[model samples]
Target: VVDFAKFKNLIGAGFINAQRGLDDSTHAEKDILGKILGKLFRSGNTDAAPSEMKESTLALKQVVDGMQKTVDTDFRTGVAKLLPGLKIFGYPGISDSELSTETTLNVGTILESHTRIRYDQGDGLFLPETYNGLGSRNLIYMLFQLYEFFRDWQSRLIENGIYLIFIEEPEAHLHPQMQQVFIKRINEIVDQFSTTLNVGKPWPVQFVITTHSTHIANETEFESIRYFLTEKNQQRTTRIKDLRKEFRASDLEIDKQFLHKYLTLTKCDLFFCDKAVLIEGPTERILMPNLIEKVDKNLTEELKLKGQFISVVEVGGAYMHHFYKFLDFLELRTLVITDLDSTALESGKYPACEVSKGTHT
Candidate 1:
């Protein structure tokens, strides 16, 4: 049921629950709340005896029940609510037919609610194999799978407990438009869950993601970003948030609008790149990634598996100074592969990396 090709991914979940019988075989002392919350979500029964259930399980069951009743009452009205300024489509003879065939996701069964996306074939009914099939659209399939994973993660969020979600390479199969809007949609959903129960206070939910999409990283706030590197067979993370001693105060004053705009214009991959090879043109950008893969398959395979791949950025020779000036705390190994096209070694046109005698950068 990890796949979400169809809205109902639970076709086999009940079978798995029956096979495992996770609760039946365990004792109260064995599956404590600490242990249960620490693990992935397992099926629970609300009808079970009090001694047999954990406090976290009961809370989720109650939350799901309350949300279910609110949605059910809207179904009795027999008409869907239309967004303002949007009118329902009307055909010549089908004006009386309902705007769209109704299909509701089963959040009432302790599942998450989903908005059904449908396309009209010949008949008006929202039939199978309409538009949900991934044969034509690959982006929808990839995002659908990510949502399935997130839905499962949400069940593990015990009330008043810290929860985290991890994702890697969310840009898979996504177009530029989808990539730009991805993090915004996720933030909206997280904000909703936090404020659902208490009006003023929200739940604490955080997540980490590894990606190569500058579009996704550009959408992210500066505070949420962290750089990662592997040095001498040991992995390290760079938290730019508290690196005041190592970085200059001026480095922290980067303009948010300029950052997003410059990255978008230059198509800079610095936002999510693990290691960077800064070049001077499109010729290197198109050829360097494949060239690196061919040079060392082992490094390439590791990067692919861990989602920490290197990025080749094409920064024009003139603008490199501005880039180096702003991102002073770039911890990733950067190789400034610029051309020594100038006769004067002392000319100021090139990037600052050249004038610094290659000591760092």
Candidate 2:
């Protein structure tokens, strides 16, 4: 769980550093905001003052000054009177030296503690983000993180480096439609930011999204998907099957296009499942679950399919062969259920007939 206010404060700190023309390497070592405020009030250095000051910064300075005044009048005076009587191991303490306190404002701390994300309800009323739905919160947080990464790129925090962002299971809280929309729109959002904020140079960022949602996988381009398969060996090593290269190696453009369109339209879960059943029609697909259950009930517990993840696909007899290469590439245990259409040749013409009466199959 990310503290949204703290993330915003970090972004604010980055912006302040950029505004001050401070070197990026020294950001961790220096308190840029504190130094700016010290120059403005304590040193009275007009030349060092920033051209613009935010209202938040002004309020923070006032709070720091009020705290300093309270410490000076109340805490310091009280401690001074008590110092004469204070003794350590029967040795009397001297009260000749006065104790002084210095107060420094930390903008990050103040803003993080005070800031809250609120949604504007009608009539100027606002509701806190905590009141929003979990799905919305998750989506908002993900987008904000992306924005922060984009800002980092725009600020040139790490020059000449590629920003590789790995978004693990972004579809966790999102609905199927929203998951599809997110996969479709994420790259567009990054490209838009790069073009608008980064001038001519593109944001050197690449996204590697890992998702179990069929909606997200369907929405993603075929070339971008990599299927990971765990081998049934002692070590159980994982193998990555790059869809683009696999399809390209076959040199079947029509088959590749057909498979891509078929998966996109059907939103098949074949990619995530352990085993698959390729059926000839809707009837077989509809009855697959019951068929598996019946078979599982009669088999031994170890051999039963009750706990196995199996995906049933209705590809029709004419198109079932098209998926053979894909299923083979995945190394999935597949059961193809297609009708064996028997035919009879008469005068060089083959016509369909019953299996018992037909000569060829």
Candidate 1 pairs with clashing backbones = none
**Each prediction's TM-score versus the true structure:** 0.43, 0.71
Candidate 2: segments with Cα more than 4 A from true spot: 1-104, 340-361
Per-residue alpha-carbon lDDT of candidate 1 for residues 1-361, written as tens digits (9 for 90 to 100): 5556332322212111111112223322222212223222242332321222346555665675675566567653444554221234544655554443344433232232222344566666664322342322334433443333333433432332444556666666567777777766876766664465234354354666777677787666555666553344445533434223333356535544445566766666775556777788887778776776576666655555235556667777775665564355665577787765533234544334543355323
Question: What 10-residue stretch in candidate 1 is worst by lDDT?
Answer: 12-21
Tens-place lDDT digits, model 2, residues 1-361: 8898555433332121112222333323233333333323322222332223234346666787787678767777776665543233354454433444444545444444445567899999998655666567567666766765565444432343566777778776678888888889988898887777566567666777777789988777779999989998999999888988877865677788898899889999988899988898878877877888889988888888977888888899989878888888888899888777899988898799989889887
Error of 2 at 185 (Å): 1.3
Task: Please list all clashing residue pairs in model 2, or write none if there are none.
Answer: none
- What lDDT is obtained when candidate 2 is compared to the true structure? 0.68
Which lDDT value does model 1 have at 242?
Answer: 28
